[model samples]
Target: MEATGRLPAVRGIDAAAPFRWLGWAWRDLWTTPGPLLLYGLLISATSLALSWAIYRTNAAFWVLALTFGFVFVAPMLAMGPYEAGRRLDRGELPRVLDLLLVRKALRQDVAYLGLALLVIYFFWGRIAQIVYGLSTWQIYRTIPEFLTFALTTAEGQRMLLVGSGIGGIIAYGTFVLVAVSAPMLLDPRASVFAAVATSVRAVSRNPGPMLLWALVILALVMLSAATAFVALIVVFPWLGLASWRAYRELVAEAPEPAAARPLNPVATR
Candidate 1:
């Protein structure tokens, strides 16, 4: 679709809007489980593979880098769910291959926006490490030992507060950049700048509901991580579909083209 001359109006939704979107997302998932489940499984397997690959190196940085960096990649990960929701809206069944069909988006602005996010995520991980370094002098050799130190020490508590604060800032920034921009990128005609601006405006206009939505996402992601990413098999897809609905609601409809600039009055006369 081509970009309309004017940007659409972003709707102001209530706090309950996020829940409603989730309900719609859940319905989309069950309505077309086969493909979404397969996509989810693939993501789960990839995450496991990454964990396994990094664990062998015994490097905490690599592990943490990928773990936290997963957030940066999630918008891309959920592209399939976004498409599924679109299909459902059109009363069409979503296909499994649609998950891999992002090649079209990749050729356009999505890939560039994704790269920008990657840079931000890399810096976020670096900031997290700096926080850890400043807060602790202990050098633990193992995951369990490190966990114990963090849980049982004053330095660890301070580190948690500092790190979490910094992390939250980075996460919020990324959310504002990608929330609606990503879906807009799926449209071939939309430029990255325009998409990002639309997203910022949407969040600005609907701060309450958007913040609520972000909190909901954070809660679900934490739950999934706590379960060792297993819960993502469901939660991940659900969030994806819901995000698509969010974009649809937030971006305004395109304006009608100017009626062939009415023939010059004098010429018509």
Candidate 2:
């Protein structure tokens, strides 16, 4: 459908669109199960090894800090699979390396990606500090005073409760925007503002499905982390493809006009 002057209003589609999109996603996975499995295993093993090393050194805090940094860079790796899926949808063959190369070509978008990460990091750090302070009140307080506070007060509990609520809102907002923006950035033709706005609107319009998707993504993310990152390779690919399919389904596609043909004297005669 062509853009009708105004941007399309968000509306419900056939209930079956999601199912159809999912079926296609599964078919794509089935065709490339080997690499996907191997990838997941490798990610799991690496995450586990790195985590074990960090824990042994009593550098859990450092590990947590590094995760803040990783959040910015890790999405770049998924760009390849994301692009590959987009191409697959368009009936174009895309190589594994194409995912990596595409990012290089879209250097400007990478800057936007970084800015998005910074926004996430700032909120995450604030939430972390609040929770950490509540957990470690004794370190800063005099021993006797700390004991008195803990024994007589509900201050820590209140801090934790408030922190959790704030953190949840930040998490939900971040998830909704980032989930779709990464793939939208891959297009390079679309503006970052448009991509993010569309993503937010998409989630708002279909809260039920989007929430289900968010939960599923969270589960997979936790599973990957629990397995030490090996699960990420498979989970990442699956999720990446699923995400691309979701975008394709939820966002309105702009219609293109028919291409003009070259004029030929023989045809005219």
C-alpha RMSD of candidate 2: 8.9
Q: Please write out the lDDT profile of model 2 over residues 102-191, one tens digit for every residue.
A: 753366765686677777767677666667576654442233443354346687456546755765576677777766667767664566
* lDDT (0 to 1) per candidate: 0.75, 0.58
Model 1 CA deviation exceeding 4 Å by range: 1-5, 60-65, 254-269
lDDT string for model 1 (95-206, tens) is 8887768554766577788789879878987887788778776556556766776678888878777877878888888999898988777676778887888899999998
Query: How many clashes does the backbone of model 1 have?
Result: 1
What's model 1's overall lDDT? 0.75
Q: Candidate 1, clashing residue pairs?
A: 8-252
Tell me the alpha-carbon RMSD of every candidate.
Answer: 8.0, 8.9
